[model samples]
Target: MPIHSFLNYLALEKKYSQHTITAYLKDLNSFQEFCNNEFDKQRIIEANYAQIRSWIVALVNANISNRTINRKISSLKSFYKFLQKTKEIDSNPLAKHKALKVPKQVQVPFSEKEIRNAINLLDEEVDFESLRNRLIIELFYTTGMRRSELINLKLTNLDFANETVKVLGKRNKERYIPLLKPVQNSLKKYIEVRNEMNTNETYLFLTKKGKKIYNTLVYRVINNYFSSVSSKVKKSPHILRHSFATHLLNEGADLNSVKELLGHSSLASTQVYTHSSMGKLKEIYNQAHPRSKKN
Candidate 1:
């Protein structure tokens, strides 16, 4: 199928992660299914903007959010663009299409106190799983790496002597993150316990059965640990990463430095975490600003 060629282009040329490729495939398949059911059109490649508009209406009527509908349309737009590139379509159907407006989503990072409490809870247990979980949490908070990067982290990525970890970020880009003392200590302890497990897995994290850890399990570990301390609705690895970047900026880290640490190609992507540090900025302004110092 033509879609397979596009998927291969994404994988081989674009160098997208499997998780990302899978999401793209899912979105395309969803649109194909919609076209099949509504317009009896088996091939979504030939679908026009009018049919796509009907699908959007159906999605809205079915209670799907505008953000989700926009994402589906984005995938379709990319597909059509690919078709244009391959000479399958002369004119792009969604070349001039405008995306639906989506409300801004602000992700609240966990507070420093909450992070401390969560770590304290993890420190109570002495088992391999507990140590591994604590290390994962520390890695996220200290390194600011994504969950996917953490999961795919290899043992060879660690450079204890230099106190840096090599992280493979989006599009298979590699960046080295400096390791803090606490994180280094956690790694040492976790590795000691991990070695006793006798597993031959190359990945950094693993389950009790000595296999590599999955995405859901990493999320569950974060959620289950943080639920005891945080009252926030979202308590996952991404939140920990958010907390990491937010807290660093709050402590007066440079925006460009944070951007590099977070492996963001552009400052705009890293700028999202700056919002979480607004309270700290206000506090600093109140204390240091000459106007605020007057009685």
Candidate 2:
């Protein structure tokens, strides 16, 4: 019951995307079920730190990764914080809790040559699906939008006149991304085919049946194409996004500008891309610095 109210708060007041709201609800429900089965507790709001710790132990025993367990804990933290703020709870259970140590992962982005090869593989002949998929890949690499943002894109969001796209980012924040001429040309070609479908769906990308696209389909599109170009174990839409930021930074783009382009709420979030750009920086330094080159 309290969880329902908290979810409503997340949806209505916090304006969290549905995907995020679902993750929060899922994490909370898992904890709730754990409390009921293990501790005979009927309500999560009544749970304390010890009970929460027991759930963490159970998750660890079940072989769940620390990163995943930490995310579940974060969901609980936000829920309990909301409960406290609304006077439903006297004190927060996770007030003094520390997040589990997660090993930092180095995400290797696709090289520019790899990305270019993948784009070149696209058929020159214009077909609806082909054009749409090409546009999808181009948009991800160029704009650095989250997959969800691309999926939820409406036709109205495309500002052809200004060569910009209005993306609705996390927490319903809006940011405009400038579209390159090639991407704009691709969009024009895709639109010509899209209009022939005669469906009134406002969403920009659609399936063969003119239905709005889903996450799996988008992931499949990116994975299928990138599989041919790169041998990376993980190929997904986010990789293209990572490539977008990495490549931009590799070309001397400033951190703050990349931060705004990526629609990051803070500079810290944008700093992760710098790690991927380090190799480029090292190469440049070695080439330009005479002492380093001599050594």
lDDT, candidate 1, residue 177? 100
Model 1 misses residue 36 by how many Å? 15
TM-score of each candidate structure, all chains considered together: 0.72, 0.70
Clashes of each: 0, 0
Predicted candidate 2 versus true structure: per-residue lDDT over 1-295, tens digit per residue: 8899899998897668899999999999999899889877668899989989999999999999999999999999999999998999999999999999999888889888988878887867577888999999999999999999999999999999999999999999999999999999999999999999979999999998999999999999999988998999989999999999999999999999999999999999999999999988999998888898573
Cα error, residue 182 of model 1, in Å, equals 1.8
Worst 10 residues of 1 by lDDT: 13-22
lDDT of 1 by residue, 79-142 (tens): 8889999999888888898989987878999988988898899877989899999999899999
lDDT, candidate 1, at 138: 90
- Highest lDDT against the true fold, candidate: 2
